[model samples]
Target: MSTNNQNDVVSHAINAAQANAEDSQAQQQVEELSSMLQSSTADANVDTSSEE
Candidate 1:
């Protein structure tokens, strides 16, 4: 193949890798946030119950 085609392939590969990494990071963030929300909700419930 020509040099330009080779460069295009390389560029596409880099972009795909970056996209995958970003998606993985986003998933991790969502998981962490979900856990934090669940923990905070449980704590709030416990505190409110104790006050009654």
Candidate 2:
């Protein structure tokens, strides 16, 4: 392959890796938020139930 082609391939691969890393981090944040929301909802439910 030509040097230009190789460089393009390398650049594309780097960009893909960076994107994957960012996506994974974002997914982790989403999971954490979901967990926090579930916990908060459960606590709120308990509070409401106790008031009855």
Candidate 3:
């Protein structure tokens, strides 16, 4: 392959890898937030029940 073609391929690969890493990080954050919300909701339910 020509030098220019090789450079383009490498650049594309790097960009794809960076994007994948970003997506993974976002997914992890979402999961963490979901877990926190669920925990808080459960606690709230317990408190309400006890007050009844």
The TM-scores of all predictions, comma-separated, are 0.53, 0.55, 0.55
Clashing pairs in 1: none
Candidate 1 lDDT over 1-52, as tens digits, reads 6445654665565555556656778667655655665566567657866887
Give the poorly placed runs of model 2, Cα more than 4 Å off: 1-22
Q: How are the candidates ranked when ordered by TM-score, highest leading? A: 3, 2, 1
What are the per-model numbers of colliding residue pairs?
0, 0, 0
lDDT of 2 at 15: 53
Question: Candidate 3 on 1-52: residue-level lDDT in tens?
Answer: 5445654665565555556656778667655655665566567657766887
Q: Tell me the spans in candidate 1 whose CA falls farther than 4 Å from its real position.
A: 1-22
Clashes of 1: 0
lDDT of 2 by residue, 1-52 (tens): 6445654665565555556656778667655655665566567657866887
> In model 2, what lDDT does residue 6 have?
50
